[model samples]
Target: MKKFNIFLMLIFIFTTVFTACEDKIIDTTEDKIQTSIKVTHINIPYVYNVTNESDITIEGKGFEQTDSITFIPRGGQGGGTIKLGIKTIEDEKVALENSPYFRDGEYEIRIQRGILDQLLGRTFVNRIFNASIPDREGMTVKGTVHSNGQGVANVIVSDGIEFAVTDQNGVYYLPSAKKHGFVFITVPANYEVSVINTIPQFFKRLAGLASATEIKDFELFPVNNENHVVAFMTDMHLANRNNDLTQFQSFIEDVKNVYEEYKGQNKKFYGITLGDQTWDQYWYSNNFKLENYVDQIKSLEFPIYNVIGNHDYNPYVSANDWLGAAEYRKVLGPTYYSINIGRVHYIILDNMQWLNDGGSQGVVGERNYRDFLDQEQLTWLAKDLSYITDKSTPIVIATHVPLFTNPDQNGNFNNAMENTSELLAAVSEFTNVKVATGHTHINYRNSPAGSNVYEQNIAAVSATWWWTGATSAANHISRDGSPGGYAIWEMTGRNQQWYYKSIGFDKDYQFRSYDLNNIHITSATYTPSATDEFKGKVAGYAGEFATANKNNQVLINVWGYQDNWKVTVKENGNTLPVTRVRKKDPLHIISYEMQRLNANAEPTSSFVTVNSAHLFLATASNATSTLEITVEDEFGNKYTETMVRPKAFTYSMR
Candidate 1:
């Protein structure tokens, strides 16, 4: 009976063990549930100067093979596929369209599986995804003071609205503005704003547009009781042994001659070398000394105020061991300091990086041995300007760069100061203000035309276009290779005038002055071809519009890279009548009609629409005869081009 019981117990134990094992396996399989991964949105950070992708690690797990990944933008737009495995995790680039430039919102990434083919072992699944690519905003307004192109710590700065002193390296920060606005320094008494007159205008608006924004980069003209004729020049880029420097002496001679001529007639004159007065050849070498440069500048008879340029700072000369101010101090004075000439206040600014070309010029003054402006100077500027009781006293602001467009349309003037908008608001409260600057070789004059102030950009007195030869065939020379010029600004009682006169080494100096009273583009005319396929070239009277034949279309190429191409035929700003063409068709000999305002018949650029004219031309291979083209400018400048249609016979008709 016991043997029977034992057999029964063994059978029972075996059955229980088998049942328990089966239950455990079922529970483990149930715990492994499908996750159904879906990518909702991908956030890509904003990048301006940087070329690489800001945020690369894409979120959303459970990426299945053969799944379709579609990118859907927020606004009404088409979708695109996301090519995976093509780019490694390390190498990813955010395309321009997907960047903060145009699209700045969430995007849906839809993923679907089993749509094209059947899954091997898993069940069919569909997943929807979305991700946000936020728009990159502009940086806040910050100020960094620099001395000797190096930061001098603890400089105070006030934008008249917000005030902050720079830290150890002469850096300060304030809130940013919504749009591109003007700003000036409440400069301390001992220190001056880089450009005191017009002030540095910061442009935060129109970012990432088809064209880069145009902000004034230099200082404005001086406005005081003195009817002074100041000669302004900068970015000479003079090396100790270069031909451009040789030509610069000639410019000085010309200025001296002009001043002497005026002086002989009992006229008053003054001069200011904006910055970069001398190219420090000793930047990396100890062979040359600061006294060598100072001696050369002292050669000029008149008292020339020198604004500190980047080249003034020498790397070989240690800033900490040497004088507090760089070697330039002996010749140019304090880097962030200012000078008062008669009723006008002059502020010399340092805007280069604190470190060398290889390093980044930090917002704070201390990081780089390079470009910066400190707090002490900014404090002095505010205190000094505050003392001026007469708000009408015209302020003449000067700097290496204008607050707007520098040499090319790409440069900005308010680079060093963070509180540029606040400073501009302060200056805007004043009645009269003007900003003038150099560094850019090109000349730009802005008056109440587009904005609310007057600004002037002076041309370089040194090498123009880096003395790049006209063509590759021409060897690259220095000043002899390009045009070198200086400016003579006349500050009168009622209005201010700027004369950008190019004084070549030996050529006769000429003066070109502009005023708001007579700002217009005159006549713009083009000739058409006779053949069915318009085959001809069009010429114009002005420099802006030229003649060209493209795809049997006579195109009067209007609009320069800097400004639009518009023309008028008379002295008074008026447009002539124009003939209409096809609806929105590429223009062909078109016209823009304008009513005459005055009887002055003298031809000026304000009387006709140069852009309104257009002409069609035949294709190059389909031409049969000679096409004549003519264009005229308001200044009576005429250009002509002929397009010879291809003839069937090789020989001439004659």
Candidate 2:
């Protein structure tokens, strides 16, 4: 119904000549006779530098000396309408005394009712690209930020070391050394560049010498993404190993389904991965890397905005940490930049500082990296936010590393972000701020009391690096037992709600329950053929499930649990006692760890189950008593399970 209203509003929106009321911008049209005025085209220059350019001419026929025109911002963001005096008006063309662009976006031109009889308030404002930016002595790269054959002004272009803003003609020239081998744009609001195979071509790859001049223009498409949704895909370690390619196909299907679902609702759907799209260790050995990743993600429906994870760096570069991202910048674009989508502002960053000490060509490095926003990124973020006058606008920071530590059952965590305070201080002015990160591959949220920032450490698409489910166990799961999945963020205006979408499950599949009475994982039961050297590790991994527990305790794993979500359990229509407990999911332990041990292989430490706070323990009256469990997510989505007594715990249990 809401979507239908939007369509109706678009169909019947009234636009016309202005009214005499100076303070109020009229919305209704005038009922006067129309005039025949033809505008061949407006000749706003291809580029304009503010220092030397000021006047912009509008071409066409009908012109009046006292015509009033106003430039109104799209989305009602920036400010109100901007008005300038008309220098000369003629039937052929008119020149306006224009000033520097105070804002960056698409604006509408509204003329006084009488001046434009038939065509008054419905025309789009032509942007004037010109600033007084002087050219450096030696300019190596030049480019234009254009859309629909018109130059875009105030669009920032950078070559890693130096930054330049487009002139009145939408032209930018950087006196760059070409060290980064590419020039990328910040991607101004309301416009997007070309996307090839789901990749936004926001940056151009430099082909020649640093001193040679290069011309690269960025073309953007105008879109109304005010009502859109973003799917946050993180840590999909697709390295062509462990049947990850096959597993990724299933992920693609899930994304296609989501795209269709949102498309039906008239919402613009987009996908942004929060890094670790490929395993660097297997870049050479497996002959699979970011290029392979691009091919895999090509099947996705929306344009892919990427974040550089720690594992995405070159295992061969040892000189500088940022140098490791040379390939990433070449393939994906800027390591840090900002883009506006609708009312929300998004900032993509590369927080991982790669430090592969022993790295050399053909020899993989340690692949070690620290997690924190570098000083350069912090500085860029501040400048980006300064343009956003509305402090209440939603700001989403997408990076590879999370700002907070993994919390236990009670939500207590230790050893948080390395530079959380500094990063937070940069965004302290914003009222609505959210930080979305991957790396942990576990689902958790941290919102300190009295703090404005809400950090949600999302789950991974390749659950446990595509291990458990790839095997005969047939269960794709994360370290916290959250199903291998991505997050679906629904943003309409400033109101945003997100859900963790487990692959092959409905949106309501928010939690899983285990009949603890039947969950007894003995070494002889799960891994009877374990080698003598690794047989002792079974009990260490199984925890309480190593022994029998017939206390009628039912364990529930709400992997997507946020602090505000509710959990309730009842037996025979009567309420049962429920306690939130920090426990490793028994099912994951049996699926990943036991499977590895049975094969006489050491379990990867990172793939093992970790104690999470999303677990809930409920006590029933007897072994034969039935139980009803219902979990409610923060968004009020309810997931319930009615379990009969003596429910069996098996490898395939849901």
Candidate 3:
């Protein structure tokens, strides 16, 4: 019995031992199911200012549409796990700035791909080291890192110099480097540095005062709080009939995009169209139906104002200046008007009959143009100005014909104006004024009247004149450079900022202020020896009203070499209005009733003539009397033996 009992005990003990060993073997087999993933690399952690450090960006190839990344503090204190939020495939940016669950400490960043309904994807685990960087020498460098926490091996840390790649494990060491320093990775392709809290482009190196330097904390630039105003328009000329509707619609869409971006902002913005709203080149018929045009504009969220361009009135163009004033009034509200926005007032003037007189067309001669703004319109303007006396109000004058030009000094085609004296007189009474126009399919800005009145001539949206050439005078280039774009004006305090961005020219295109700082009265001068042609030079005042008061009697000294030339005071080309105070002395106290005269009359054949013996007279004084004078040409272009004055002025003064 004793022998049998002993044997049974031995058997039981053996069975127990064998079962325990089997169980242990099975547990070890199950543990092998979870494959350990080796983190191939951990990029440099993004470092923003250490103070408000919040958003953290960790980029790598393993992230997917539905992956969850959890961040945990490696050793605890002030650390916690943060789950990654939804990821977007577009823009490819992970916004971690708003996440509040993470703490400042060494963190274990682990990402797991694929979830409940999907198959397994890759997994990654990385350690993030956060430490405060002190100022050294004259620089302060803030830094962060990702590693396996062991002596990081095979790691590379660069002060942008002397690259030091680590050993086998991912370990990096930034040795005591320069005082004021810069450190950036020699990032291999497919790898990106942490760009978070840094400049927008992260791959670039990091820079700052060194650890031993006394550093000043960086203060972020103030945000732009000023409201933005964008002027939008399309189908300006309706160059080609077939292309009109599409171009018009596209313009409205572009404007809509601008309005959508700044809808809630306080800056009030709108659009303006300089008529021709339809293609009217060939047919007297309306370009695209007006209903369609209005529908397109109504699609825009902002209000739009229109001015009748020539094409809009081509129906009556043959009669009295294309579509006459009565028709223009019926089609697009008033031909001229005014509106006020904020402290700025805008005056819209109609200049369709630009060639009413026999002078050059377009920009050069103003007399040839029909009574552009009729007497009725001029009266309205005076009334408008009477109400607009506040010198503080900024005024913008808009017309189809730009009032200034940089034309070669003698070009007869320079269509600025024959009667601009009246306009300048009216405008000089105000403090802040600007003028804008577009008839030249080019982008040019000039202040012929006065630089203080910012004058801008926008480029044409359509390159109709030069549609086929390798090089055209229109000054247009490729698509981004063409199909044209608009200007964005932003006002902050008393400063007016202008930015011209081409269509599709990157979202960041901005208007640059070109040397407008030292703008003051002392920087300019007024001169009385100023004529349409022999305008005397005024220092620092390129485009200025050279007016002198007779009471002030500021003498303007002028010199003429030849004889038969006598200088005298006059008004509107009339020697009658001119009071002869002194001869030989060019200096004269300018009376408000100032007349323009020249030693001789240079007859230009290019100008249209109403009669056989005459060219259009620009000033009224020369119209009454046939002023006979010797004509001379320095270039020796054919000169008539003697120039004869015409019987009548261009068109009777409007």
- Top model number, lDDT: 2
Candidate 1 per-residue C-alpha lDDT over 1-654 given as tens digits, one digit per residue, 9 for 90 to 100: 999999999999999998998899888875453244433344432222221243223333344444544444432111233322212222222222222222211244444554332211211111101112122234344434544444445443433334455567555554434121222333332233331111221111112222222121111132333555667866666655434445556666777676676567543455676666655543334344444544445455444556666555654333341232345643343444444454565555655444533321221122234333344445645665665677777677776655554222222233323544444555665677776676655445444434445566665676332232222112222121113566676555434554544554221222111111112223322222222222211222222223232332222221111122122221122322322111111111121111111111222332222221122112222224344433343234343344344312111110
lDDT tens per residue, model 3, 325-349: 4444433445666644444566777
Model 1, residue 219: what's the lDDT?
A: 17
Per-residue lDDT tens digits of candidate 2, residues 449-491?
A: 7889998889999989999888878999888988989998999
Clashes per model (N, Cα, C within 3 A)? 118, 25, 45
Worst 10 contiguous positions by lDDT, candidate 2: 122-131
**Candidate 2 root-mean-square deviation in Å:** 20.2
- lDDT preference between candidates 2 and 3, better one: 2
- By TM-score rank, best first, the candidates go 2, 1, 3
Quantify all predictions' global Cα lDDT against the true fold: 0.40, 0.79, 0.39
- Please give each candidate's TM-score: 0.41, 0.77, 0.38
> What is the alpha-carbon lDDT of model 1 when measured against the actual structure?
0.40
TM-score of 2: 0.77
Ranking 2 against 3 by TM-score, winner: 2
Candidate 3, superposed: residue stretches over 4 Å from native: 1-235, 239-242, 264-266, 283-292, 321-323, 354-371, 406-415, 449-451, 465-483, 492-494, 507-654
